[model samples]
Target: MPTTNDELPESGRKITVTEAVRLTTNWRTYLDDSECDFQTKAFLIPIASIKNLLAINPDAEGVRAYIGLNDADDAMSGKLVLVPVVDGEDVIFLPGSNGDPDVENDSNVYDRSQNCPPDCSTPNELNP
Candidate 1:
């Protein structure tokens, strides 16, 4: 059973082509319905970054994605913030460069992902 999001399964499941297409189609519908002009279809995150985030806590179950905006007033500046999740909850990191585990801070999160548009996949079934 999935501990965090009820929408997600216990583990990664392989879906059929039809299912994949349906999911993508639904996502597209959402973008259109929401009037998302800057339809950011995907984000490119480095594997090393993910590894580093996971290294912060050996018991990390997974990384949670948070919708962010560079400029809170601008919806066009949409971005994805990644945070390590432990025990079905986000792990708040320490404040400052010292990286002390005791001190808690909300700013301690990852957002190295490149949003699609200028940085995107070569028109695949998912991003088409």
Candidate 2:
């Protein structure tokens, strides 16, 4: 059976700092071992975009991020697409799909998160 909205928690669970560090460290180690050019350490999504996604529906519980590559041919161009989650299901807005004209500001999916390397933050335990 599928997880119902009522069965889901109101919010996500939290993790401790130690656990967070371990997860990040594991990812870093994997990236190093893989020796790939796409060394994306992190993605920075603006708060405005999040707000916009949330504003799409009043009942939105949260946002779900789907890892994606901007260009299928370019592995370095990795990206994350965010969609609003309502009742445990992704709420993707597809305006004007029924023969009507597309409206501006009718989109719910968001991308363009600043990736690390060029837009990385100052040296920190997570980014270092």
Candidate 3:
């Protein structure tokens, strides 16, 4: 089981990854606009390409992505949203540097373990 809201200074609330996914039922609603308005190829890592590479080389280092997916067994849909945390009534993903998309697009996916930056060395604290 994954930890959620490991160190949220904003709310100081602890959460589980399952709960976070449940809260973000509409995670994909704003993705189109966000991608169109502020996007760069830097943050657009193709999932298929990664899989192909991994298949060829089993020793390959896989991506450390934090994806927001709907857990409804009846309907399956998921998108590569950034690291998300339960904040109040909303579940939000951290935007890239200065509202750009390149930050999350990097090869290093945000590490969801440990506390946030300046406090803990765990990486990828985009919105913490």
User: Candidate 2 at residue 79, lDDT?
Assistant: 85
Q: Residue 113 in candidate 2 has what lDDT? A: 89
Question: Which ranges in model 2 have alpha carbons more than 4 Å from their true place?
Answer: 1-13, 94-106
lDDT of 2 by residue, 1-128 (tens): 42654665656555566888899999989989999777888899998887766666668877888888878887667788998888798766643544233643555678968777568889877777
The residue ranges of model 3 lying beyond 4 angstroms of the native Cα positions read 1-42, 62-128
lDDT by residue for model 1 (11-111), tens = 65556678888897898789899986667767788887788776766787788898877876666676888888878988656323566655444345777
* Clashing residue pairs in candidate 2 (N, C-alpha, C atoms within 3 angstroms): none
User: What ranking of all candidate models by lDDT puts the best one first?
Assistant: 2, 1, 3
Q: Each model's C-alpha lDDT? A: 0.73, 0.75, 0.36
RMSD of each: 6.1, 6.3, 17.4
What TM-score would each prediction reach against the true structure?
Answer: 0.73, 0.76, 0.19
Candidate ranking under TM-score, highest first, comes to: 2, 1, 3
Q: On lDDT, who's better, 1 or 2?
A: 2
